[model samples]
Target: MACFHPLTMMLTLVLAARLAAAVPFKNESYPLTTVPGERPWNPIEPLQQRLAYINATAMAVSWNTYTSLPDEEAVVYFGTDAWELDRTAPSRQSTFETSRTFSHHAILSGLEPGTEYHYRVAHTNCFGCSTIPTYSFTTALPAGDCTPYAVAIVADMGLMGPDGLTNSTGKGAGGALLDNETNTIQSMVQSLDAYEHIVHIGDLAYADYFLKASTQGFYGADNVLTNATSIVENYERLNEAWYDQITPLTSQRPYMVAVGNHESNCNNGGVKDKVNNISYTAQICMPGQTNFTAYAEHWNMPGRPGPSQNFWYSYDVGMVHYVVLSFETDLGEGLYGPDEVGGTGKQMSGPRGKTGEQIEWLRQDLAKVDRKKTPWVLAFGHRPWYVGIADAVCEPCRLAFEGILYENNVDLVLTGHDHVYSRSVPMFNHTADPAGYDNPRAPTYITNGLGGHYDGLDVLDSPLPANVAHGIDGVYGWSRLTFANATHMRHEFVAARNSSVLDEFWLVRAREEGTCVDGEEGHTGKDNGKGHGKGGKKDKRDVLARLDE
Candidate 1:
């Protein structure tokens, strides 16, 4: 055996680099996927999705194998530097039926933030031996201050309607209406399944209903999420109804969810667990933001997240503060919540925005608003101030909170229950003005419940105050939000049917500080502010591959 000198060690490293065809920019630019599987002639190859999502402080590392392993458990070896084999972590033993699709989510927390970590993921479950070593990512920055963030937002996706989708898939146009489509929203678990149900049920309570009756509050209490076999199975069940549906236009985007009434209802409560509510309304769980008026454990969001419970919570992404509101929560009485949970007189009187607590939080939150730091405040709920469909009390919350928004100088208001694309002129307290008199920019409003939900109220039926800018109807799609660094933000309604830009508008705030008033297109106070209503580059992760890819 030749004695390995120091120079010999260097030569060995060089030789290894030659043998391993280095893949640079892995830990840098993402979209890192595994290699393909082995062919009949080729040696057993590595699966595509080897190491899953690994964050700065956490890693969901996972792997798969063909045969059963001799060992009894699956282990993931990771470290701060490269392969520190010294310190490590072992995951719980898990086994799932494998046929091109077998996996598990292992959330590795307690990781050091803002630090580099590398390691290998291997499985020891009944399989002889298999491991994928080259996988890594820097831990995420700590939650508060400085750390940047991004998220995907979707509405009325994976829906079923009379669009004649024989497949019911809603998986980005292919894979049949209800085909073998993978999870289109893999990056973030959002779906148009409610819309799919709208279609599966023939866009009506049973059939032959207009947008008002059929799509209005289409949120059934069936707990369709529970009724379906798997999420993908649910996607397939309504195949024919929404076969060619297209979404995931926001995958790769770490976005949260804002419930649409169509999501579920007190009646749709069919989950295995006696769910307090049928709607699978997710809780952002920011600290000091929950009501916990429901159940003890399950009703409460796991992982001591940010705050708030029912739905109101503020999260930071980059320099933006996204406040997602729950329309089904308060809104007077008939809306929901409070009663089952508690009300102002009954419990606290109203939901956050509609109640004293939330209003107080809003006042303080807005009072402590550091526009210099955040620069952007975007709020989203599942109801609209205007859907173009003439309906009484369609936006009761708007009536209640528009003043709150005006007084607080809110930036934007996004809602989606009307099922149509309508961009309102920055109006305050039902007043149509483009000047955004309360602040530099009027609180912009965009209704994006278009992601292929059962098409409804395909007509402008709302009181189009002179402040109304542009509106579209029956166009199934989503809203493309571009956060162009602080001061500037743009939004466009992407039509799901043909991937076209339907209604487009933007919230352009004045750089100079002071109060500005927004009037109708006329009122001629400031610059006409006319430009290409809609034009911009597609979000790199618009429709990402959220599947076993």
Candidate 2:
């Protein structure tokens, strides 16, 4: 028999203990609250109803049904009045083989901008369809409209209840668990009037985490079953629970999202195999787990034609242009590539070749923005380029898209992944702009991933980076961005528990004439530096007329 050294034996035991501690065990006894009246009266009853913006004149409505319906029967009826739904639009149905239910979607088009419309989703073939209650949503303001609007930003939010809290403490990053949701959800519900839409950067639900724990026997010996049938039912319940939890908000506003590492693989741990010594895992991955199947099928974003369309897209809301990018894949070599998870080579989304397609698309999109019409450009993704945690910082993502964003003068960039909140001064290449928030030349970066989730908070690096303006890890909260006008925007980080303002700042920029100075053809006048009236007020009508050329 081989004898091991005492020191080696001691180290081996310590490593094992840490590994066991890192694995989260399921609390089977924790009570999960059922959504009021969520039990379907029929197999075709819709749940998890959500809305997304397609354009100024259109909005997309989607919901989940236990059973698939005929394409012609998946329809929405709508009108401006709640009593009479005078319009109808046919819908399309889709589902992943790994999913137990079908998703139905329909677009309400020819809508008036900024007008509230009441609608109801139903299957015409079903009996007593009129009993479905009516829901209402407002269309986005037309581009070039300088009306003020606010948007809510959240990330890393998991399913409400015990699943979202730390198992040992039975609490979140904030304090005691108040109800099913973290402070973020309660806060948003209380201040519904504060924002018109919600931008969920990524990690919508912890479904994959649940699946991982169940397959690894963390849920209990009886929950160790990982068959295809078990996996499908596992995700179905988790997805429905999360979507139902947020229906109060998503049903009323456009719930925009981007892809995160949690959305990449089934196990939510990373890839399972190895390529040339680099490890990747596909051990428990099922059909719908990879390729963002569930996320893509559930959402119908207005994405341009490309393999990464659902992952990367842009939309204009009032005076701000919002661009969503994927930090999980299509980002060429280095960490955050398809073959890695959270920068660790231990797990991955497998070998997805980099085509540089996303970056190229970003370039074209940013190049086409006419700043004279929409003065503020905000880009958001799942991972952060500037954060307090070193490991959480994605240098590869910064290398890929920072130059283009800076060149185009993107006003702000939002990201989540660190589970802590940190804001950086307007910076490029790690250097803070001397002008700061006052007409800065570079984008101001913020990591607002503190929307409470199962993993709890991430510890920030001591001696925080010089560029970080504000950093917090103890509290669970979300940020609100108010596009006050063409020249002024305000951002506030609000505490989830009490709805207190934790941090606030104003980003001010002068509306320069010929702001189309980014080399887009049309106006050739130089910046007079006197603000809007320097050449004459160029309103929406003037911008629209020029675009008609």
Candidate 3:
């Protein structure tokens, strides 16, 4: 038997008590402004990268300020080629829930397409602070043009550390860590010359300090399990670091995004249901706010028909009609019953008599896809309707949206959430509708959720579903889509660690005049003027009839 000293025993008892009383979010500090030199007057310069709405000939920029100054206003100065010192866009200022931090968003409109513009963001009253450096961005190619472009897709991108422990600023998980995932995609940054659009499916900056501590075995993981104040403070810190990491690349291109489960907390985007992500709503500001508040506050996205800003929306880039949606809300994840492990009830909101709003929205959106005009209709969301993972399957999600995707003849359906890279054989209704590479009859489903997060990666099922073509896990990577032209497009998975091309395939558009065309040309996926594609007066009233039954 070993004898313990009285002092040692006392210390051990104290430690045990402390651990036992640890709260999930119990920070005593009121405001945690971690950004160096973050002043209430000057504030931290807009850290998040600028997001572009190319179709509207405008760009939206946002940043965080520690405190608000009386009569203080946020402004962005811009001009073609150089800052003409003439044109200015005033910002709409508002405060977030995390702290007294003020958020500012300014939209610079009336710009020309495919043209260069220089700009700077600043406080209207900060007289002594040096002006923010000028950044340049070129507007996207004019809409309706048969121009060639590429889109880079990344998801679940969490904190990046330099020594696998600390980030560029020598901070670890508890601070503004580096985005190694972004570092891995540096080549994609270089490829930016060709890829102008960057789309993040979901799960941006896993700063869930307020939720609970992460036990996924990563050091300095910013999960403060004891303090609420520290939680918000650490959140702002991690967020600032995240914005800084992507600023360099995003400043030059358009960064589009979709919401995921992580953003479902505490009024984040005005939501507090089965999923509660208060941080997401407070952080991201998009176009549609009456329903989704935070998102509406930040982004000036195009094609917002009202109601929900980040819920579901559509826009056209070059020859592609891009649809962005929210799976957490769109799939009725919050409306399910018992909230138990497996026992569930009602996948969507409202009774079963009528199709839900999202389903109806989808039907109308898909019915309007004029292949001849845009050539390809690509739909993206955070969660995948069809995925083959041992513990991450969402059958209800499939039941919710797969039918609409198939009925619409969408070319490619991209999703993230499974934390792995997977491509399904052109699939429709649980069968492998062989449309391999060229003219896929069924939309090809690809999951690129391996964006390197501390929560770890997902495992693959021993035997994949019959419709799954390829699947890989235990790797970090992103997906790339190259719109070769109106008729052909290429998709590839690039390993982030080394920028290696992991998987590649080509999706050919089925033209009305041909059997299965592979080369680029006009009339990519036109409506054929038969009430199917475009300009068809096919009674759209039946949009929800299928769902009702």
Candidate 4:
């Protein structure tokens, strides 16, 4: 990181380090005016990394103005090209809900798909304050069957640039924080990205603050039992340090994301004790609002969960049907979910019924998927029902939907909860389908929980799933899912250790047509669907077990 004032270049466009280093003087003549600094303007929330939305006829921009700036209008300049600071889309910042952060949304209509637009933000008037740069995002691709070269898959990126906790172990040149899940995200702050679209598997920044009484402002953890309170105050002081890590990468790419268990109130004993994080829901300028307001405001993600009836939505992205489901609660957990457990000393609930809803939605969603319209059906959630890791407390819970998906011929399953990467064989009933080798068998499964988390790496309690050719661990990395034409897709593990491909392989959907991920059989003599990956080879493990028999 170096600094040199250009004797040749003028100050019209100052590129100052985001740190507190004296901002390179642009001009004393045009002192930054408007947006009174009396109340902190601060870094905007739900920071956009790489926005990869579709040609939404109407796209909105929104935010919060903190409690002190009681009166102001939320404005956005629009149009496809930069420079011409014309087109105005204005919405008054309405003072709503409780708390100090004033939420806002401004939906701009008539935006063309696959096109870029630039805009600026202001409260009092669009002047003087550090000018919100000319940011542009490409809307989601049109709804049809087409193919893009590559898509980056990253999980557990909770809006921080660093991994928070520091530890040194075995990352070749010694371990740096990036060594274990570095924020080398290819989104935000760039001239478009090589990846047309990206998917953030889960666990976004633990946003729970206004001007969180910390040096940086906010912490990047989930807002579960803690709400957005200061219990994680120490985490807040880390904003400056973390933001310095990822924004550069994510801002450059068009990103699609999945929710992690940490984003909402997973630990609260009572229902009301739980809060819907505005940080996890809502897009700026949209009329809707929520608990994780910061997330909804800044990221402007669509179809979030909760009483808002927003979570678990799907869209089309060039030859693929991108389905995002919420496993944090939508799927279910006896102690933490579904039926609303006991309210006393211990809270316990059966599987959340959203599974059934999503199951039905999946049926309808997939039913609507005319192969001609969107050829590849790719579904993802935060929790990976089948992983290599084992829990000492209890056997890991397998997803109830694996059976449904297998029966439906899903092309791929992607997840992020486990903080390490693990890829399973083309399995149906927890065993590899030798049929996986031919044209028309079972769907393929890819696990890339390695995008980076402080939880450390995960080791398999079981053996490799049949033909799992490649795997890596003890290092941090992100997954890249590359689509090669219609019938072929490749998964590569990009290690932050050195940005190298730790593990890479191809999944030929046209090659394995009838395969399923139903899990292995149990003593009950029925397909219990528990994640039991095959019993060795040769004389034992049955191919596609249940189906083979």
Best by lDDT: 2
Model 1 — TM-score against the truth? 0.51
* Local distance difference test scores for all models: 0.38, 0.70, 0.56, 0.46
* Reference-based lDDT, residue 52, model 4: 36
The TM-score, computed over Cα atoms with residue i paired to residue i, of candidate 3 is 0.72
Q: Best-fitting candidate, measured by TM-score?
A: 2
Ranking by TM-score: 2, 3, 4, 1
lDDT of 1 by residue, 510-532 (tens): 54342111201111111112221
Task: Give the TM-score of each candidate.
Answer: 0.51, 0.81, 0.72, 0.67
Model 2 regions lying over 4 Å from their true place? 1-39, 129-131, 166-182, 211-223, 270-281, 305-307, 332-354, 514-549
Q: Write the number of the candidate with greater TM-score, choosing between 1 and 4.
A: 4
lDDT of 4 by residue, 491-522 (tens): 77876545667777667756233221111111
Q: Model 2, 1-549: lDDT tens per residue?
A: 012345534543543354333222222111112232234545676677889998877999998787888988878888776667889988888898687678898989988766677788777775453233567777776667665567899998766654444432311223335443335765676766667789999988777666444433333344434576666666656766677667767777888998777776566664222212332244566777676677878888887633455688999876789999887777754446633554553335533334676777789999998888889999998889898887677777888778888999999999998889998999998889999999999999999888876555787888788889888887889999877567778888988878788898889888778543432222222223323211113333343342233
**Stretches of candidate 3 exceeding 4 Å from the true structure:** 1-44, 54-56, 69-72, 83-85, 128-131, 162-191, 209-225, 266-298, 303-307, 332-355, 513-549
Candidate 4 is scored at a TM of 0.67
Q: What is the lDDT of candidate 1?
A: 0.38
